[model samples]
Target: MKARITVMRTVGAAVMAGALAWGVVTGAQTDTPPQDASVEAVADAAPGYAVEDYNYPQADKILAEKNIVLKRGDGHIVLADCASETGLLEVWARSRDKICFKVTGNSGWLTLEIPSVYGVKGSADQTAQVDMTVGSEEKSFDVAKNSFAAVGESADEQGRDYMLVEIRTAK
Candidate 1:
């Protein structure tokens, strides 16, 4: 009876070992090329990384529609409707009657082009500095809060027309 029991235990162990060996052989026999190809395909389909250039959005559309050439900015300063708010910075140009911008945050900057700019109306909360140029000479003007300041030809001794190129403001 003991010999029969021992034989039965040995048979059970052998069967388990054979099953494990068969499983390993079967797993090894399966082709890995398809799996590698699927991984490569997934990698190729992945999207590229995003980057920010700080350029103004819809600039070309705005230029075509409103004739305003907005270039780059820190996003704190943005073009605004003149009638929308009272504290907006107002720019007076010969080419255009009036252009307005809203300033936010601790500081802001915008680069643009407005020919024949002569005056700027300051916002209530922020002090502003405008940069303008005529021919090869450049000039800067400081505008007080909530006040109108003469700039470009209005302030220039020679009364040369100046093109506004940049605006900077701080709270």
Candidate 2:
């Protein structure tokens, strides 16, 4: 019985290996079957395969802790600690103690939801526009480069709570 079990395990491994080999061959097939030298070229990673490389880093951890579902960005705008720096984009919130974003590059964009955001600071070279929503009403604000500006509820005399939805930057 032990010998039979060993044979079955070896057969299972061989079957798995063959299946993997077949999948690789079909996935890498171009107009022609991949030959020895052309195999490497034909097996270039698929476009769909490369997309996952750009996923938000540490996304699961961030989402679990912050309740922030940061989906995707251009890699130019990213979350920053409260005391990060002045020359980058800064977000001041009423409820949140520490909320900021570090924006690099001449042009960048990000989409997120931070409730009760009241103000923002923009970098000198990077003019920024932010989209916010208060209830069903949506508002946009233009923050001059290198300056601080009131946004969301801070701009309202009623002191309504507004959620910052998106951020765009351009040179």
Question: Which one is best on lDDT?
Answer: 1
Which residue pairs in candidate 2 have backbone atoms (N, alpha carbon, C) closer than 3 angstroms, thus clashing?
A: 123-146, 124-146
Computed on alpha carbons, the lDDT of every model, listed in order, comes to 0.93, 0.82
TM-score of each: 0.72, 0.65
Error of 1 at 37 (Å): 15
Worst 10 residues of 2 by lDDT: 46-55
User: After superposition on all CA atoms, how large is the RMSD of candidate 2?
Assistant: 11.9
How well is each residue in 24-135 modelled by candidate 1, as lDDT tens digits? 9888687567644644567668798888898998999999999999999999889999999799999999956699999999899999999999999989899999999999
